[model samples]
Target: MKAPTNRRRAIAKALTALLPLAPYADMEKIRAEAGRAHLHNLPPTIAVWLAIIAHIRHAHTDYEKLLADGYDRDSARFFVIEQTNIVLTRWRATRFLDADDESE
Candidate 1:
């Protein structure tokens, strides 16, 4: 059979990267289970990753609205701080990946 598409592969790559390596963090396992959602066919991990991104996008919009509305200073600060850390983490993770480490 042919391999999955570039978009799907990129998704599996990214979600695998985002998730921690803790004992219970079995991304592959999650992928397998998610596959069961449809018999004989299932969405790729990348699809799930896309859904996750969508969820985060919604969260970000809500956060932005809160900040725009002059919500509590502490709450706004905390949201922005976390968002900043996430952005930086993703940037570093994808930015400086060694050529040898590019294999997935």
Candidate 2:
């Protein structure tokens, strides 16, 4: 079997850290939502990384910074913020459902 790439390793580490905060987080759901939001061609790992960075940096993260740092400006903006928004919205809805279930 081929070894995991560095990007995959980074994503795994990020997911490990995020799993504690969102134990019910569903990567498949996030990926699906990102695809629906027109991020279909974006790599799943890149999308996940963007989402993780968005969560970590919150409002402090800027798409322009990504562009300044040499990322494709439009793609970076869409994946980092727009696509992450779709995933986060789904995550929030899932959390609400879990809360509702617990309240019952």
Candidate 3:
């Protein structure tokens, strides 16, 4: 297969420019997930950011472990909000998640 088809390249480019601190493994997973999300025809920017957030949620925090250990999705997410925000800051994200704002 030809490497980095245009779609993959577009996602990768956006991620590299946006989340430059992301490790290689994280970037690869984000690129692949973003590529799949593009099938929904979301804009590249939307897809990239969505994938980035999902990666941080699943990889950087205990969100997934909580789910595996029997916490419901919402509760698991609640437990990890600050953790995700920390990773978000470490990655120099333009936006940070605010749990209180979402609590309403």
Candidate 4:
């Protein structure tokens, strides 16, 4: 197969694996809507990762603001750093493991 095809396939597989079941609090209508949402506007895994990275980067300033408002800096800092690591690991795994597939 061509490089771009392989990359798309790899990224699709990763996205499928990461896709979570929509939460339903016993509401059939809501559940159905969620399913439709998943089908209609699903974004690429790379887009999701980029969003997460952007959120993490934005949180730094938000965290500082909260700290100035007298919130605990350590807790906020730890939470931000911890989530950052999680996203980074996924990004690395997707980039490295799928390198040959051109999915990175």
Candidate 5:
């Protein structure tokens, strides 16, 4: 419980630092969800970047649908990589993946 609280604080601090710099209108929701995700399984070590990636995966790509279709995690992510990167670029993310980039 205490560890989860620390993780949430870490995510909130990251969101506070990053949200003002980004142009997202729904950043508050993203930040909130990211914190929840961190508690579930999303790594808190790189919370901000993972939060952005989660946003793109859910919002801009068919990643969840692909997973539901029985595609493995890496495969689903692979299928959506380009679309994910496009949204990453739109968000001014510094780390856009090339098609040839190793996903795992």
Candidate 6:
């Protein structure tokens, strides 16, 4: 596998620097869960940020209410999903050539 691009390194660095701000109830548990979820295949630093995002989103229950609101929920969820997809796609495209790439 190829080395990660400088941009990916920078993003991972920034994400690590911002981890203290994640609203995690128990960071260790979240990290453990992330590891258990088999995210170790990702670059260690990038995986940390992904885990943080996953934990934050998992802990946020407000989405349930939005989801129950029918049309409004559908629109909001669609917007969020699309935005997330775009961001992830861009990140992957500019960073690692493949999801299973082991190079950091």
Candidate with maximal lDDT: 3
> How far off is residue 102 in model 3, in Å?
6.0
Q: Candidate 1, residue 4: CA error in Å?
A: 8.0
Judge candidate 3 against the unseen true structure and give its global Cα lDDT, from 0 to 1: 0.76
Residue 52 in model 6: lDDT: 51
| CA deviation > 4 Å runs, candidate 2 | 1-22, 25-36, 59-104
Worst 10 residues of 6 by lDDT: 93-102
Across residues 1-104, which tens digit of lDDT does each residue of candidate 5 receive? 23367776777666655444455565665666666643456565356666666777877799999999999988888899889877766666556666686733
lDDT of 2 by residue, 1-104 (tens): 22236444545554544433343445433333333334334564545544544442333346656777787745554545544444445444221112122211
| Global CA lDDT computed for model 4 | 0.40
RMSD of 4: 11.9
lDDT of 4 by residue, 1-104 (tens): 22245444544454444433312231223222323323234444554444333344344235566567676855555445545555446434332122123221
- Top candidate, metric TM-score: 3
Candidate order, lDDT descending: 3, 5, 6, 1, 2, 4
Pairs that clash in candidate 5: none
User: What digit string (tens of lDDT, one per residue) describes model 1 on residues 14-82?
Assistant: 555654441233455444433333311434554544333333333443556776798874465444545
Span of ten consecutive residues with least summed lDDT in model 3? 95-104
* Model 1, residue pairs in steric clash: none
- Comparing 2 and 6 by lDDT, which wins? 6
Residue-level error in angstroms, candidate 3, position 21? 1.6
C-alpha lDDT (0 to 100) for residue 92 of candidate 1 = 43
Candidate 2 matches the true fold with a TM-score of: 0.27
Q: Write the per-residue lDDT of candidate 6 for residues 13-89, one digit (tens) a residue.
A: 54545454433354555555445436646665666666554543334334454556654644444434434344344
What is candidate 2's CA lDDT for residue 58? 36
Give per-residue lDDT, candidate 5, residue 35: 64
By descending TM-score, how would the candidates be arranged?
A: 3, 5, 6, 1, 2, 4
TM-score of each: 0.28, 0.27, 0.75, 0.24, 0.61, 0.42
Candidate 4, which segments miss by more than 4 Å at Cα? 1-43, 60-83, 86-104
